[model samples]
Each structure stands twice: as C-alpha cells, then as structure tokens.
Target: MIKVEEAIAIIEANSTKMPVELISVHKALGYVLAEKVFSPINMPPFRQSAMDGYAFIHSIKHQYDVVGISQAGDHSNIKLKPNEAIRIFTGAFVPDAADTVVMQEHVMANKDSILIATMPPKLSNVRPKGEQIGKDEVVFEAGTLITPAAIGFLASLGITEIEVYKKPKVAVLVTGNELVKPGKNLKKGKIFESNSVMLEAALQTIGIKKTKVYRVKDNLKATKQALKSILKKFDIVLISGGISVGDYDFVKEALLQNNVKELFYKINQKPGKPMFFGSKNETLVFALPGNPASSLTNFYIYVSPAVKNKMGFSEIHKPKVVRKLNAAITNNTGKTLFLKARYDETNVTVLNGQSSAMLNTFAIANSLLIVPQDVEEYKKNQLVTLLPID
Candidate 1:
C-alpha cells in the first residue's frame, strides 16, 4: 500500500508515449501533433478582395470608368489605367493594377462607369497577401491538439499529410460470476453488470474509441489466461472488480503468475483503497474496485490521466479548482476522502451519500472535493480543492 501521490508518481514514471506516424490531415482531427508544423504557403497567396464591390485605383475625383469584371478564381490580370474600376466580388483576386476596393452598397453604377458614394482611403477592403500567415512560419507546435479548423487550415495550404502521435489500444476486463447483464430477469443474489458499458463510455469521452471489453469468471485459471493474453496485445488494460482479498479473489495471484510487475497494490485512501496498478513491459494495468462509485472515481483520478499522458498530452489530470465551502464539514478518518460535490463559481456544496457502493450522489455531482488526509475540519466559507469531473 502507498499514498495517493506516491501511486500517481509511479504511474507517471512508467507511462510510455505512443509512436508517431504520418497520416492524412483529413483524418487527423482529435489527434495530437508529434512534430512542429510550419505553414507551407502564405494564406491568400494573392491580393484578395474582402468585399463584393468594385476594385479600382483610389481617385480624389470619386468616379472611374468601369473596366472588365473579375470574380473568384478569375486569374486574368486586367490592366487598369488611372481611375479605371473592375467589378469584383468577395474572395476574388484583386488585379495588381488596382489598389483599392469600394463596397457595392456604397457606390452607384451608371451604364459603363461607377461613382464612389463613400469616402474611402487607399487599399480599403483589400486583403494583402500573407496577411494571415507567411510562408515557412510556425503554424502549430508539437503537442497541439488537432481540431476541425486546423484541418481546414492545413488543407488550404495544400498539405495532405501531418505527423501525429498514434492513439493507444485499450482493453477493459470485468471479473465476477455473480454479476448479471442488464435487462435480464432478476435472480437471487445477482446484480446487473454496468461497469463494462460505463467504462466504455468514459473512455470515449477522453477521445479513446479503440477499446475492447471482456468478462471473466472468478476462477484463477480464467484470470491468469485473460491477463496473460491482454498484457501482450494492449497498451492499457483496465480491470473492474476481483481485486480485493476474498475467498474467490484470484486477480492478485493470477497477476503474479503472469509475471506482471506490481507497481502499487493499494492506496491509503477512501472508497478505492483496494485498487491495484501494475505493468508488464509497455502494457499498463489498473484493477479497480467492484463498487460503481469507487470504480469510476479511480478511473477519473488515475487511469484517465495515465492514458492521456501515453497519448502525448502534457496536461493529463482532471481540472482542479479552489472554492469556498457552502456548508461546514468535518473529517477525522485519517484517510484521503474523495467526496462528491456541486460547485458554482464561488462556493461548493458537498452532496450526500458518500458510499463507494452507490452512485446516486455521483450522478448529480459535477465535481469531486478532495479532503486531504491531514486536514480534519473545514468551517463554512473556508477554501478547499474541487476537481471538476465534467
């Protein structure tokens, strides 16, 4: 057994970053960049019109002879003498001979010429080349999370591929024979199994969609076989239940038989004190308690961060905030308590039902208030650490 901080430090030390691969930028959304990317070409490679109007040389006379027209994607370089205007639309390339554009709404058109109705200066409504980003400039740094806008930006630059960190392969194992699948008829001493689907959804929320779930009986042979097989294939393995010491508990013994190195067996904390963490080569394993609240709590506190860290994210932990308590509380259990709570901008209210077996309070709670092992009492309005789970 060890402290919570000690367990977290061990996990971080053992976390391995996934390898980088060059993939199509079209498929790179929700992935992290492994290398710094530079802009391949200047944005708006030519002088672009910023409005639907007329392009012309600025004249104090406020009138000009209408020349040939130019719309978007028209590349003909129409020569313009002094005071000659070209009918132009938004996003069209501005002719080099013209230096300014006037919005069509402000100008009156005659048969073959137009009178500028608005007093505008030179170079108005014209987007100069390279105004957004210059060629060979730093566009994104390593570890940037790719988003939809990023893909469009790269595509506009004519870049088809990008270097990004590969996503992790995960496997979830649920162990227990007494568990029953949901929607089945209720039987004697049987509970509906939910941790498998619950964990799968949680994994999806963190951008990890490649995962497999397995259910194992409470026997040593099946436990050993499952552990031995998944440890060879997956980057991260999460097991729910069958970790505590009981007559049928075989996970600890089976893990030893499979030669998985034990990094930490337990943590001196509330709800999830029986949680287990281990590793085999590059494969990391986490065995959480059977209770719903405890399992999800451990997942958010430990597994999620470790998985995101392996995906090349620097900030992996859940967001922590400090707020004053809405109600007074006292704790003298001499163990760290992860209490479910709801917090507004300035104050947090601790919810009822802190049992590890029930998730009634956790469902309505948006944050977890960590009561340090050393701190005993918190008067109303005193500051405390609040970790938002949503």
Candidate 2:
C-alpha cells in the first residue's frame, strides 16, 4: 500500500486538462476558463453619466442654459459651453467640456434654465472613460472557475462568448447483485441502492454535470461487458463495490483480463483501504469500496480532484480548517484515518463509531478529521486538520 499523498500525486500527474470550446457567456457559469480573457475595449467605452442630473462645466457655477437632453443610447455628440449644461439621464454619454454632474435633486430645474442649489465638484456623478476597466487589461486569467459574477463581468466587457474547458463525462457503476432500486420491496438479503444516487449528486455538485449511473451484477461476463462498453463513452468511470477480496468480487479480475493498467490498488487509509484506480485506453477508472461512507470519502479524496483538474481548475482540493480536538481519540498506527467530525468556532468533536459501513454518524458530520499514519492517539485540545464539506 502507498501513502495517501503519494497516491494523490500519481493521480494528479496523470490527469490532463480537456480541450477548450467556445460557449456563450450565459452558459459559461461553473465552467473553467481555457484562455486568458483581455478587455477589447474600455468597460464604459466612453464618458457617461452616473446619475440623472445636469452635466456641465464646473467653472460655470450658478447659471446655465439647457442645451440638449441626453438619454441612454443617444449617440449625438453635443459639446457644452462655459455657461451651458445638458439634461442627462443615468447611463447617458456625458457631453464634451462637461466635467461635473449635479444630481436633479440638488438642481432646481425650469423649462430651459436650471438653478444650481449645490455646486457639484468636478467629476461628481460622472463615469469617466475607462474608469472601470481599460483596453487590453487582463479581465480574467486562464483556469478560472467562471461564476455568475464572472459572467456578468465578461458581459460588461461586451464578451458574448468565451472559451472554456468542456465538462467531463462521468459514468458511475454501482455493482452489487443484492442491491435493489429505491421504492422497491426489500427481499431477504437485499438493500436499496444508495451509492449511485449519492455519488451522482456529489459529482453534479462539483460541476461535472454530465453523468450516467449504471447497475451491474456481480457476474464476470456482465461486469466485463459493462466495463468495455462504458470505457469508450466516458472520460472517467467510477465503480462502487466489488473491489474488496470477497467471493463475489469480480471487478479486479475483469479489469486485469481486459488489459487495464493498474495504477494503484490500495492506499494506507482507513474507511477506504480497498480503493483501486487504473486506466484503460486513456479512460480513468476508480473502484471504490462498497460501504457508503468509505466510497464517498474516497471519491472526495481521489476521484473528485482528478475530475476537477481535467476540467482545467488550478485548485482541486477542498477547503480545510484547523481546529482543536474536544476529546481524546485513538486509531491504528500504520494507516491514515478520516473520521467523521462536527466542528464549530471553538472545537471539533469526532463522531462515535468510526466504522466504514455506518451512516448515522456521517449524516451529521460537517467535517473530516485527518489522522496521519504515524499517530495512534490524540489528546484533548490538540490541533488537527479538518476538511470541511463546503
């Protein structure tokens, strides 16, 4: 078995970013940027009004004649004289020679002339050209995760479309003959299939929107056929169960028979020691443990980062926090362990029953306590690393 960090490094070194494609700014949300986006023109593009007011030269303080009215989209250029002002609405272009704007609330307006009750300062309520962004400025760097705010920023720069990395296709295979679909009557030794649904949701949350879930029985022929068929369709394949050395486990045998290159079989970790990863014809596959908590933990630690890296994200790790332990805990000395934990501002407390198959403790866990392989016990108030869910 290899260390978790070594396994993570192996997975990351082999992963490559996907090809880039042009997508509409509206559709680019949650996608990773493929290229650096530079501003072709200034953000405002021209001097514009920032408020509904009168645009005039600050030198002419008290009295001014209303020369023209400027509304949004009025391209007619009107230059202002020393004693002249333009009745401009918000977002309208500011006329030349007009360096100040007195809001209508402060200016007493008549039919043709306005009285300036408050002398506005220069450039007040006026958006100068290129004030927000300049031409050729780097608006967004490559490998950025485009969010709604980013989309708005790009739109402000008149970018209707942008290049972004394509979302990776994922195939989730839940293997177990004893597993039945939800809402079905459970027989003597059958349980409802929950891993598929859980993993599918988890993948979607990380921006891998294209996913397909399949149910495979524990037969050699069926498993082999399914693997062969899916290998050609998906960029990443996730197999739940059939990885441990059980009598019905056939995934390892099928993978080896199909000439799949095994990268690593297992890692020195608790709750997910039977995890396996390999590649077949450029398609990556992960065989996670059957237990629900173990499968999810392994997915977050290994598979999720691989997918994120392939999608062109620079950072693939989740947010972690440092907290002091509230109680003492002990574990095996040789294997790293991720125990379900609940943490707040003051302390982080481990949940009871660190078994891989248990779900009750995982339900209320907001974080995971990462215990390295060399440590056997932790005393109270010991500082530890906590991987937060969000």
Candidate 3:
C-alpha cells in the first residue's frame, strides 16, 4: 500500500498528453488551446460612435450645421468641418475629423441646426479603433481553456478553426456477475449496477464524449477478454469492482495476463483502500473499489486529474480550500477519510451516511471534508481542508 499523495504523484508522472487537432471554434468549448491565437484585425475596425447623437470636432461653440446622417454599415465619405456636425447613430463610423459625440438627449433640434443644451468632455462618447483587441495581438495563449467569451472574440476576428488538444476516448468495464442492470427485476442475490451510468455522466460533464462500456462476469477468463478488447480501443480504462483480495476478485490477475504494468495496488485511504492503477503503453488504467461511494470518491480524487492532464490541462485536481466545520465528529479509522460535505463560503457541514456503499449523502454533497489519517476527533468550528466537487 502507498500513501494517497504518492499515488497521485505516480499518475502525474505517467499521464500522457493527446495530440492537437484543428476544430471549429464553435465546437471547441472546454478544450485547451494547443497554440497561441492572435487577432487578425482590430475588434472595432474603425473609430465608431458610442451614442445616438451628433458627431463633431470638439469646440466651445454650442450650435452647428447638420451636414448628413451616418448609420451603421454605411461607408459614405462623411467628413465634419469646423462648426459642422453629422447626425450619427450608435455604432456608426465616426467621421475622420470628428473628435466627439454628444447624446441626442443633450441636444435640442432646431429648423436647420441643433442647440447643445450641455456639452460633454471631448471624446466622451466615442469608441476608438482597436479598443478591445488590436490587429495581430495575442488574444489567448497556449493551454487556455476555450470559453463562451473566447468563441465570441474569435468569431469577431473571423476565426472559424482553432487548434486544441482532443478529448480522451474512455472505456468503462464493470466486473461482477451479481450486478444487474437497473429497471430490471431484482433477483434474490443480485443488485442493480450503477457505477457505469454514474461514471458515464461524470465523464460527459468533463467534455469526454467518446465512451464505451463493457460488462464482465466474475470469472477470470471473462474479465481478461473484456480488458483486452477495451485496452485496444480506449486511452483511459476505468474498472469498477473486483480489485480486493477476495476469492472472486480476478481483476488483478486479468490485468497482469494482459500487458498492464501495475503502478500501485492500494492506497492508505478510507472507503477506497483496494484501488488499483496501471498502464499499458500509453493507455492509463484505474481499477477503483466496488462500493458506489468509494468508486465515485476515487474517481474525483484520482481519475479526474489523470484525464484532465491527458487533455492538456495545467490544473487537474479539484479546487481545495480551508473552511470551519459546522459540527463535531469522531473518526476512529487509521486512514485518511473524505467525508461527504456541504459548504458555503466560510463553513462546511459534514453530512451523514458516509458509509462506502451509500450514495445518498454524496448526492447532496458539494464538497469533501478531508480528515487527516492521524487525527481522531474534531470540534465544532475547527478549520479543516475541503475539496470542492464539480
């Protein structure tokens, strides 16, 4: 067995990054950039009016002759002379000679001229060219996550395709003959298998769309055959159950029969002590414990980071913060325990139903309270480390 930190370090050292590919910017959400992206042209492209009013050269004169109107998308050569102004709407290109724009509410209309009720400062309502982004400027650097705002900014520059790291292809294998699909009649000795569906949803939330699922009986031959097929097809393989040293647990033997080199067998942690990690060539494998809560916990703490790293992300783990505990609790386990918790800005409530098999508490938890391996008891309002779950 190894400490949890050592296990994470091993995974960090062994994780592989995916190859970069050009994809449509519209479909690049949540992907990390492979190269720096620069703007081809100025964001505004021209000095534009910021308000619906008059465009004029800044001067002390309160009145001027109305020359012509300039609306958006009009390229008419409308230039302003001294004591002359043009009726311009918002977003209309300001004349080259115009230095200021006054709002319509501040100007009084006359027969052939307009009276300035109040004059604003020079360039008060003008949007300068390239105010947002200049031509050939670096807008986003490599490894930046593409977001909705990024899409809009890229579209403004007419960028249709962008280079980004591809999402990993994943495969999930559930090993247990006693497990049956949900919505089916429960037999006397069988329970509904839920780890596959749960893991699938979890992966989808992280932007991994290519996933394949396989079910194997508790026999070594069946497990070995499924592992072989999945290993060839996916970059990441997640096996739930049959990792412990029970009589029926054949996952360890099955992995060894294949080419998977075991990195670690167990970790010094509660709920998921029998977790396993290995790799065959470039593919990463995580064989989590059989319990529902335990498997899910391990996925968040371990597998998610490896996946994020493979997808070229700099930050792979969940965000951690220190918060005060809302209540006191006693932990007799001699291992590091992650308790399901709900937290606000300053405090966290350690929820009930923390058993390895229970998912009820996990459903309501937004955070995990980390209790160190050596500590046994905690008092109310004591500060503890918390890991926020996405």
For model 1, give the RMSD to the true fold.
1.6
Q: For candidate 2, lDDT tens digit of each residue in 1-390?
A: 899999999899877788899999999988999999999999799899999999999974698899899999996488778899989999998887888899999988898999999887778998989998899999999999999999898988889999999988899988999999999999999998899888988898889776899888999899998988888898899999999999999998888887888999989999899988998766888999999999988988898899999899988998789999999878765899999999999799999977898878887898889999999998999999988873
TM-score of each: 0.95, 0.94, 0.95
Cα lDDT tens digits for candidate 1, 99-167: 999999999998699988895789999999999889999888988888899999989988899998898
Off by over 4 Å in 1: none
Model 3, 59-165: lDDT tens digits are 99999999889999986587678899999999999999999999999999875788899999999899999999999999899878888999998998999999999
Off by over 4 Å in 2: none
Per the 3 Å backbone cut-off, how many clashing residue pairs does candidate 1 have?
Answer: 0
Q: What is the C-alpha lDDT of each candidate?
A: 0.90, 0.89, 0.91
Count the clashes in each prediction.
0, 0, 0
Residue 46 displacement in candidate 2 (angstroms): 0.6
lDDT of 1 at 29: 80
Which TM-score value belongs to model 3? Answer: 0.95
lDDT of 2: 0.89
List runs of model 3 lying over 4 Å from the truth: 110-112
